[model samples]
Target chain A: MTLPLLQVRDLKVHFQVRAGGIFFANYLPLKAVDGLSFDLAAGETLGIVGESGCGKSTLGRAILQLLPATSGSVAWLGKDLTALDRAELKAHRRHMQIVFQDPLASLDPRMTAGDIIAEPLRNYETGLSSAAIKARVREMMEQVGLLPSMVNRYPHEFSGGQCQRIGIARAMILKPKLVVCDEPVSALDVSIRAQVINLLMDFQRALNISMLFISHDLSVVRHISRRVMVLYLGKVMELADRDAIYGAPRHPYTQALISAVPIPDPEKERAKPRVLVAGDLPSPLDPPSGCVFRTRCPKATNICALTVPVLESAGVGHEVACHHWRD
Target chain B: MSASVLDLKNLSVRFATPEGEVAAVSELSLSVGKGECLGIVGESGSGKSQTFLAAMGLLARNGRAVGEAIFGGINLAAADENTLNRLRGNKLAMIFQDPMTSLTPHMKVGHQLTEVLVRHRNLKFPAARDRAIAMLRRVQISEPERRFEMYPHELSGGLRQRVMIAMALMCGPELIIADEPTTALDVTVQAQILDLIRRAKEELGTAVILITHDLGVVAGMADRVGVMYAGRIVELGEVHQIFNAPQHPYTKGLLACTPRLDDATASALVTIPGQPPDLQQLPTGCAYHPRCGNVMERCRAAAPPLMSTGGGGLKACFLENFGSVQAGTVVP
Candidate 1:
């Protein structure tokens, strides 16, 4: 097997809920991401599927070391990011970058689009002067389909889709080996979403970069990703190639997620019985005792609740955490 | 044949924007039966929402609407504010896509529901409160009694939408105009909401005109479907025919664009390849001609009238033989 470009093992992130000052000090932890493990091979796109509070975003942030991880390892290009100090981490930042969900929020209002993209290069590459940075910024802007003349425009002047292209240009300017795109296209219009997604795919092909693409949109993930991992309440439920995940989802939760995607065809929609799971997702801070999906799983037996099911190999390269795969 | 619950003939809606006078909906003709759901599907600026919004007499103050809106013998187009105000929440109720905007934030859910009952149904506070709780329960909202005191902020998006439905249906109106009711919801919850609407419409025997851009939602919810484009009803027919045998090029384009899970036999979706037309300057002939694959010289200059296509379908395309096909049956 080819060596993975990014390796993550036992990654955990917990927010400290400080309490009790008068009598006895007590600390409660909100385990947003706990013991999560995944890997992204060279030039491969790994899609993360989960709902809003499922810690998928937290895992992304933890991998990038944007948020401090409580424990575990994030090995990128033979370097363990967990042990890196502040200065060392800063030095290693150029190879890995992220694109946030809301493009408007990520960019600065005061800075022009050209300056925004150049800021990363300027801060990291101090040897390069202003003139060289401008040339590089112009090249990156055109690559992402933004007009070079509009480089002087601010974030507010551009539409949601354009702002996202600017965001992509900023992320890709560093020439990162791996990009963590967290719901980058969710905020865009449906028509514009396709354009941005196609652009990203094109850029990825040209750069030969690996991406940990985290999004709730299964269709978008299916279109671009090589592999997909299903997360539920801070735990992995299923992980497989994109085709298997979208085509033949093994886990019950994965099945539910895919089935829930609104198929635009009226006839096919009418033909299929919608497998809508009842109730909201279980809180990550206080997840269920055993299989995370047992609470909502239709075929869940008492065994599912009593014992946690580890990822068992279902077929070639398909792993699912369902307690009862057969009868 | 059954009398139409709501019918609009040659309906047109325009807004005076900073740019120009834009016709959001133009020459649109459609109807709803006594208990039927007519799903209007289209993209943004297709005027799907605006068409229904005009029919409900709920367009913003600046909007200009013309043509005929004959609803159970009353002409809504020429109706005064007092007439519209009287008929709005009681006679014709509309539920929007976003419940947060439709619902008042500071007010308790119960109080809002009760206000509708008290004002339209003419019930007193205690009786209204009792009915509101019953309405909440009817929509399958959990703990209706205690939930009554909670504000809009306290409820989830799905729950708040349920509350909105309860309020919309509280008056027990003849026509319930729901505009993209499930667009803001998750897929699983979207199915659940559709089920709720389906059940409530049946129980109450209310006619619904569900306007949505999601064809999947329309497929599950609608009895009949109307395809809109650039502010006009380009195609209208029974749901089965519209899905199985789409005739218009624009309609075919829409059908092809959808991504389905079970549909592994996927073809490259033929997207319309451009933004929805600028309503201010709608194309001379078919608004869809620019993006249409089967464009002809005749399609570029002459606007196709909304004429009936035989077998209970209506289409507006220069390419379709409308007059000879449906004979002489008018839409409404």
Candidate 2:
């Protein structure tokens, strides 16, 4: 079998947050990304979806080695990224890049559009002349639908959508094998969102770059992703092909999450049955004992709290972590 | 329609900015009937929120509102602070997008709820407290008694929103202007909040004006929707008509731009080229003419007025028979 482009095994990211008053402060381990395992093909999009505190962003950062993992490994083409030191990881940074959520905030106000996009090239290809780098930057700007003439304009001068194009141009300039998009279009207006998403899709198709697209917007995820993974309380609840996850989500949390998304068609939205899970997500500091989602899972029972449910195959290319998935 | 609870006639809101005079909302006219939800859908800077903010007498210091917002036989736009204050929390209430910011961080959540009743309804402290707790329970915040004493920060985002809803329902206001009430909430939590709003409308028969950028939210919650662009209501129609057959070019482009859950195909999303209009220096004639796919010479010279679509809705477009026109053929 051909090796997957990226392999993540039992990856975990835990933060030690200080709790209580200053005099009686104690550290609590916040399990942000807990034992997540997945694989990305050479040119495919794996969408990570969950609510605000579900740690989808943490998983994306952990896989990219931007955040330190507490345990397990992330292998890129058979090389373990977690095992690498700062110097070693620096060498591998050229292979991976991230597109952040807040486009304006992600970009430096002092940097011009051309310099921002050209920074990656300057860092990676030290031999390239300044003129050559400028040419490449302008070309990438044009490719991303930004006018090549606006290369010298500062980040603040551009609109939200244009700033995002600059950010995408920077990420794509490296020609990275994998791009991690963390809510890339959430900040954009509805009309502008489609534009940014299309740009990313176009880049992915042309360059054959693998993507770890993390977003809370299920509809956007469904549009761009080949496979979707549902996360709840820092654990994978269900992972399957986009069709299986959206069409026939087995996990109770997945079902509720999918049902909660309001369809644009008024008639269909009104007719659709909603499976709303009760209560908010439990604190990551002290998650539920066994299945993390058991506290809010509709199908949760005594057994769910007694024993942790491992990811089990339900069908071809579909895996769900639920005690009563079949039901 | 049922007895009009709030009728706005040519309401225009302008803000005095350092750059120049910014027209936030211009020549907008709409009404909300009893027990009806009139959704105002628009992107940021489209002036959906400002229209209601002006009616509520909540515009910023430099902002000025003209025209009439007739409610309870009073022109709210021209009403003084005393008249507006008396009506604001008693007959009218607002639930903002961010619960944390809208709520008083320093005060107990329960106190905030009771204060509304005590001040607006002339309910005494003990009676107001009882009503506040009951209101909390109605919004489905578990252990209402325990949650009452807690500050807004102690509660989760969903729970805080419930508290905000509970506060809004304290005096049972006739008209509740919910400005993106569930925008900051998670999808699952948003469902719960929206359900609460739906119940409030259905059970209490209170009129609601839901202002949001999300079409999906409007689809589920709103009975009638008004699609706004460049400080104007470009399309006003029943929810079914708006979504099923949008008449305005901007509204159509917006509906097409939104990624639907059911459409999982690999087709490229139809983008409305260019960005949202700048409020300060909006394009002359039709503000949307620059980005609109169906732009014509007439559209460039003269802005279209709100005209009847002959389908129980109004659309601001010069195009004749927009529904029958083919996609690419309209430009000529």
Q: Which candidate ranks first by DockQ, i.e. highest?
A: 2
Candidate 2 per-residue C-alpha lDDT over A37-140 given as tens digits, one digit per residue, 9 for 90 to 100: 99999999999999998999999899888899999999999999999899999999998999999999999999999999999998889999988998898889
The best candidate in terms of TM-score:
2
The regions of model 1 sitting more than 4 angstroms off are: A16-29, A103-105, A110-143, A146-157, A282-287, A301-308, B265-271, B277-286, B289-304, B307-312, B320-332
Clashing pairs in 1: none
B1-332 per-residue lDDT for model 2 (tens digits): 68999999999999998898999999999999988999999999999999999999999999999999999999999999999988987899999999999898999987898887888888898898889888888999889889999999999999998988888887778999999999999999999999999999999999999999999999999999999999999999999999988888888888888899978786788888888888887888899898877788999898899999999999998988686532221110
On a 0 to 1 TM-score scale, where does candidate 1 land against the true structure? 0.87
| Fnat, 2 decimals, each candidate | 0.30, 0.86
lDDT of 1 by residue, A1-327 (tens): 767888999898888766567677777777788788877888899999887777899999999999988998999876899899999999889988899999899999999999999989988888998899999999999888788999899999887778999999999998888899999988765555656776777767788999999988777777778899988878889999988888888888888888777666666776777787876566555678878788888998888888999988988889988877755
> Individual DockQ of the candidates?
0.30, 0.73
Q: What is the TM-score of each candidate against the true structure?
A: 0.87, 0.98
Worst 10 residues of 1 chain A by lDDT: A188-197
